[model samples]
Target: MPSTLEQLTSNRVKLTVEIPFDELKPSLDKAYKDIAAQVNVPGFRKGKVPAPVIDQRFGRGAVLQEAINDALPSAYSSAVNANEIVPLGQPEIEVTKLEDNHKDVLVEFTAEVDVRPDFELPDLAAIEAEVPVIGVPDEDVDERIETLRQRFATNTEVDRPAQDGDVVVIDLEGSRDGEPLEDATAQAITYKLGSGGMLKGLDEAVTGLSAGDSKTFSSELLGGAHAGETADIKVTVTKVSEQELPEVDDEFAQLVSEFDTVDEMRADIRKALESMARLDQAADARDKVLEAVIGKIDIELPQALVDSELEARRNQVSSQLAQAGLTVEQYLKESEEEAEDEDAFWTEIEKRSLDALKAQVVLDKMADEEKIGVEQSDLSELIVRKAQQDGTTPEQEAQHMMEHNHLAEWMEEIRRGKALAQMVAKATVKDAAGEVLQLDRIQPDGSITDAPAADEQAEAVEADASTDDVVEAPETVEAPAAVEEEAPAEESAEKKPAARKPAAKKAATKKPAAKKATTKKPAAKKPVADK
Candidate 1:
């Protein structure tokens, strides 16, 4: 077989192939046998009809057409391989030549599609990025603690008027344009004062109302049969309840947590807050880095990929609408948005989808360049971890996910995360305080570093000090006493006269002093000469 390829576009290719009848013999044989089984012949078993007799009856051109039809796909595929063309979608095949004398078969096809682009990956190591360091404020922890308290709070009946955060049980009736609505009446409905349920004014109508108190307010119903219609709603407060929070003491701590004391509970909460803060910071940092890198690189994405993603996004939106008890048309009608606003919807989805696709391409390229890959063991461990999180057995989860091709997606996510972490580990990261933080202190970077030698040296010194203190206890005491005894003897050998006699007695004093000095000199000289 001989084939020629012509470049149609960046994504499309045209291939013209020619094969001799000898090369197409196998396909012709198979096609003839297939035709024989499907056709009826007198005095012959099914599938036993002779090819030459069938050709005589059906016309030789028709039989040849059937054979060419059967052989075209494989022949085209072979030509594609021979020309090294990677087709995205189906090819448009044309039989350009049909030989009357079983000579050469010429087939021409054009593949209108998108092929994966070939380009060298940008230098990721040279890409500089800053991971934002977000400080977890004290107020954030306090807010989290308050949320926990709210989760544990119980509702209690209150004699006072209803207020925000209080649940009110009420009898309500609504009327639209002086006509009462059957669907807008409730004998007893419990509604939170600020929850924005019922209607916009219903919450405000119930607010400040004590038991047996009633109020009337007008508002528009946003959905249902009375959508966009203004209604006068009368609400009577039957009961008002307020949340009662548990005391924050040791007993409360024991009731809510496994800890025995409030201090221990606070410590645990602090640690949890710190861990969450670190994770949030790491995620924010990763996004900033990706945004920076993406901004620095340029690549053209396949339009086919974008179109496929757009269709997928449309299906997803339709599914969500179906889940919400509405069709896509009904959803658009209810939202007061146009059903034909596909351009607007797809415009937004396409931008996000393209960014996601580009990020994936960048990550995959980086993974390849860095030789970053997820091992089978690592994938298995990840599956086990996810199974534990979802409260299922690893094998069951793995089987379920594999059936849906989610296992591959999960592994890809892991690989991308690992690659991003590797990049972060190599980059310079500083905290809000302008202090460089080690990668281990932030999050797992799929790598480990040994402790510094200075730490080992300090440990060795501490061990030596401890051993010396235990071994030389008696020598320490004797050495101090020996130094004390020598101190006084040395001081006595260096003693001198405190003052000189007056001028009148100088001569007499000088003579005595001279004799004492001579004796001291000899004593000092003896000590010096002994050395």
Candidate 2:
């Protein structure tokens, strides 16, 4: 087979291949064998029919058609390999030349793909980013504790008028132009006086009303029958009740949480709030770092990739609409959005998709330069953690993820995250307060606090410490180039030694692991069983 590559664009190429008769012989022989088993030949056993006899009976053209059908896939693959084209999706193949003389078959095809961009990544260390450091105020923790207390609080019947925070049980009806609407009537509906339930003005109408008191108010229906239209809503205060919170004492602490005393509970709350604050700051900083990197770099994305992503997004939106008991047309009409106004929706999705794609491209380039990677063990640990989160066994979750293509997609996300973390590690990040900071400090696991400052003494110490750790864990396991680029970022950020944390460590570390572990054994064992 002879093949030639035609350059269509920087990222796309068309391949033309001519298969000689010699190369097509095996497919022809196989096609004849299949045909011989299916057809009858006089004075011969079922499997003993000669190819010449079969061809003479069925016509050589019929045999050639079967041969071409059997040979197309192999020919196409060989052509792709010959030209070294990494195809993204299916290629549009067309038979450009065919002759009955059996001299040669000329086939031409074009593939539109998203090839890896060829560009040098900017120096990540030179990128300067500000990481936000938001302090969790004491009020925030107190407010959270109060909310928890309220959650456990009991409701007691009150003889007085309903007030904000009081729960009221009542019967209600709504009407448009004085005619009651079918969907707007309810009986024995329990509602909190201040909660925005039932309708826009129903809560306000019931507030400050004593038992048996009735009030009528007007509201624009937010959903269903009279949606976006004004209607009269009537509510009655049937039974008024108020929440009675337990006193904030040792008893309350023991009742609501594992803590023995209120002081202990308060300390836990403070710690939790501090942790949340740190996480928020880290997330904010990560975003700023990415924005800074992207802003400084000028990279051109393939138009084909953007178009493909847009098509995928459109399909996703259509699927979501179908799930909501509406077709795309019905959704547009009901929401008062024009079908032609797709530009408005697609414009937003496109911007987001572009940002996401740009981030991935930038991080991947950086990862390649930095040689980031993830260990198989790390990936396994991640998969196991995900399984636990989904409330299933690891084996079951792995099967589901594999079947749905979620596993591969998730691994890519993890790989990208790792690369970004590495970039963050090398980046010059400052706190919102303008203080220079180490990346580890802002990482979710608090190990960022151990990262060396830009000082010579700290750098020397950290270098020595890292060398010792590597020496101690001498089992060298190589990860994929893409995985390796990001693996270190995750490894360096996580202080734990084991990829899958020990049972004891699991209790201490509630933060979810980054990936799921897919055991090839479970999937492979089934094939063996079938055999």
Clashes of each: 0, 19
Off by over 4 Å in 2: 1-3, 17-88, 96-114, 178-189, 195-198, 208-214, 224-226, 236-238, 296-299, 318-346, 361-396, 405-408, 435-531
Q: Please, what is the whole-model Cα lDDT of each candidate in the order they appear?
A: 0.55, 0.57
Q: What's the true lDDT of residue 90 in model 2?
A: 48
lDDT of 1 by residue, 1-531 (tens): 777877766656677777567777777788779888998889878899997777776665665666666666666667767876444444555655555443444333333334434455545556554545645566765565554565566778899999998867788787877788755666766666665535767767787999999999987654444555577888899988896766778886776677888788676666666555555455545555565677777766566666765566556554554444443333344443322554554454445555655666666566667887767875776677667657999998889888986655666666665656555555555566676655444323211235424322212111111111111111100100100111110121111111111211000000000000010111000101100
Candidate 2 local accuracy as lDDT? 0.57
C-alpha TM-score for every candidate? 0.60, 0.67
Q: For model 2, how does the per-residue alpha-carbon lDDT over 1-531 read when each residue is reduced to its tens digit?
A: 787877777656676767667777787788878888898899878877897787678876676666665666677677666775544444555555545444443323333334444556677779887766657567876776665665666788899988887877887777877788865666776776664534667667887899999999887654443455677878887888787766889997777677899888787776666655555455555666777877777766667666765566556555554444443333344353323454554454455556656666666566556666756764675567667657888888778778987655556555566666666667787877898865464433332355444432122112212111111111111111100011110111111111111111100001111111221211100101000
In model 2, how large is the Cα lDDT of residue 150?
Answer: 56
lDDT of 1 at 14: 70
Predicted structure 1: clash tally = 0
Model 2 earns a TM-score of 0.67
Best by TM-score: 2
